[model samples]
Target: MKHNELKTKNELQEKSLFDKTVGRRSFLQYAGAGAAGIALVAAGCKKDRGYENPVMGGATLDFKDDFGVLNYAYALEQLEAAFYVKVASAPPASFTAAQKAYFQDIQFHEIAHREFFKAALSTAAIGSLEVDFSKIDFTSATSVLSTAMTFEDLGVAAYNGAGPRIKDGGYLLLAGKIVSVEARHAAYIRDLISNGSFADLNSLSAFGSNNAGGLDGALTPDKVLPLAQPFIKTKISAINL
Candidate 1:
């Protein structure tokens, strides 16, 4: 699909006053419109059995509407939940008792976020994704904390970027709530690595005057998908956010 075409269509939809007050039922209806076709395509793919056969091709995300945006968030949440689950299950040997406890908390939060999106999207939600974490050293504290920071930061940016694309006020509000949590997670992880770097100018880019607080970065779907693609085995293409 043409990027400009989809953007124009989304803009037109956003311009409608009716879109702003869309209820849950109407939101699901709009989001689930393309679910059947995508599900059919996904069902045809063979599932992988174990770690050796990690990579498996799957349905690409259809970024045709607001549903697409929600699914995008759902996909990222799935990846994060899976990662944190693994970490919490077997924390790095070098991690302190406090670190282990903090990681467990993060794991639960990510799981909650993942399940919430799944329920919100309902039939429109994508199937379970296959993840590839081969590059991460599970036994290394540095590796684990660094990756957590990356995911949390990316998640905050993703929601910020996608907020305007969500036509339904309810969905946007929910996204805001979730992103705030993600931002907190990012801060915690950052502080774990380097004290007082939670809202550092590097991760949270500064705006306005030098004295002004740093603003978190926002990344459109096109930008976020590439950074996240490596950790996911399933194929995902936004073409254009």
Candidate 2:
């Protein structure tokens, strides 16, 4: 990464909206709702065994190179963009105006991320994946924010784990930029749901020991897919990943 680019990313992180204090109303927006209790449809998904074998059956991430990783990221961006678009179309009745506006901003960011990967991958990009959000309750603020938190956290982990696997520095740089935005989204959503819990032990423990080192979590493709599979209806045949 260029020195200026690095400095810009650092500055963005330093000025992250997650640093703001939450108003009591925003903190208790969904007083009786249990965000943790919202579950995804993981019934038929298989546990990820290894990278060599193709676990998902439909869209082909069949490349044995960095294209495979980029396509994987593209697929995830598709899911997230689709999700935010859905939420923005009809946000929960209880959401404050500011909350709704922030979600719209997030929607734009996810779409831009999705388009960047699609354009970068060009012909190698996998077909747009179908999403299954049947398990999410979009009408409830707690459910929507909880699912958003899940996606942003997963996105950050996916990028962190895949970064070391890319052979090209340019691609790595792109991933770094996108992942930092994702981390910001994760932190903001976490704070919205529960004030000051953005980098708490509970969040860190979910993705292993990033907490011990005071870093964000990372998860290999093998571990990320099965958890993601529930929300993604399109089968991502990730082979040689």
Candidate 3:
């Protein structure tokens, strides 16, 4: 199917799920209005965790409050979406037919996630970000899948770490839903890298838990942005975070 057609199909599926669980209107209501202030108020006492670097010099992420956090997520989604779209557009020759299909499905899902954030944030959302994948060898299965694994792991951590700062229950719920999907993608990619390694120690460690408790790691924005910055050419300013 064509890119636009695939995106539409996936969006319908996401909307259906959203409607069944929590109507889009209701979800937006929760995420809209004073949600940003509430998030700010909730995390007001904490020291700012925004980041900056001389190398980062492009689209800035003006994180005003919880909207800032959401925008951070939006930015990450943009990166992941871009990466998957590129891979799905022309998967590695070494990748099996099933793997190619999986990448396509993941591409749709990431695009849906990216679009959802853009719509939810509306005027508050950041612009689309430019990504640098020059280091990734798209024609090689090991290169592509490894890079995918890295992105998925970082995404899961970014959401987990930012969860506490989200004061609004509605926004929190939104983050929870998206992060779960990210974790699933991480596990799938892990297995693709090495069978039965999905739940292994290294995989669990990605969540920041080195112990048997299997807790997922929550990386603060300062930490996440640096790791993500390498792939993104946009200069993300989280000074207000």
Best by lDDT: 3
Candidate 1 TM-score to native: 0.73
lDDT of each: 0.70, 0.69, 0.71
- Residue-wise lDDT of candidate 3 within 1-241, one digit each (tens)? 6545544554454454454322223233323324343233223212211221223346566555566787789889888988987898799998898898778767656665766676556555676676889999999999999999899989988999899887757678878988987888898999999998877655556457555666777788888898898898777767766
TM-scores for every predicted model: 0.73, 0.75, 0.75
lDDT for residue 176 in candidate 3, whole number 0-100: 92
Which stretches of model 2 miss by more than 4 angstroms? 1-57
The positional error of residue 217 in candidate 1, measured at the CA in angstroms, is 0.7
How do the candidates rank by lDDT, highest first? 3, 1, 2
Residue 72, candidate 1: C-alpha displacement in angstroms: 0.4
Model 1, 125-232: lDDT tens per residue? 678788989999999999999899889888988898888888877668768877887888898999999999876756455211121545677887877888998998
Per-residue alpha-carbon lDDT of model 2 for 1-241, expressed as tens digits?
Answer: 6545544553343233123211111111211213221111111111211112222458867536677888889888888988987897799999999898778767656655665565555555677676899999999999999999889888888889888888767677767877877888898999999998877755567776466678887898888888899998777656776
User: For candidate 2, what is the TM-score?
Assistant: 0.75
Residue 142, candidate 2: Cα error in Å is 1.0
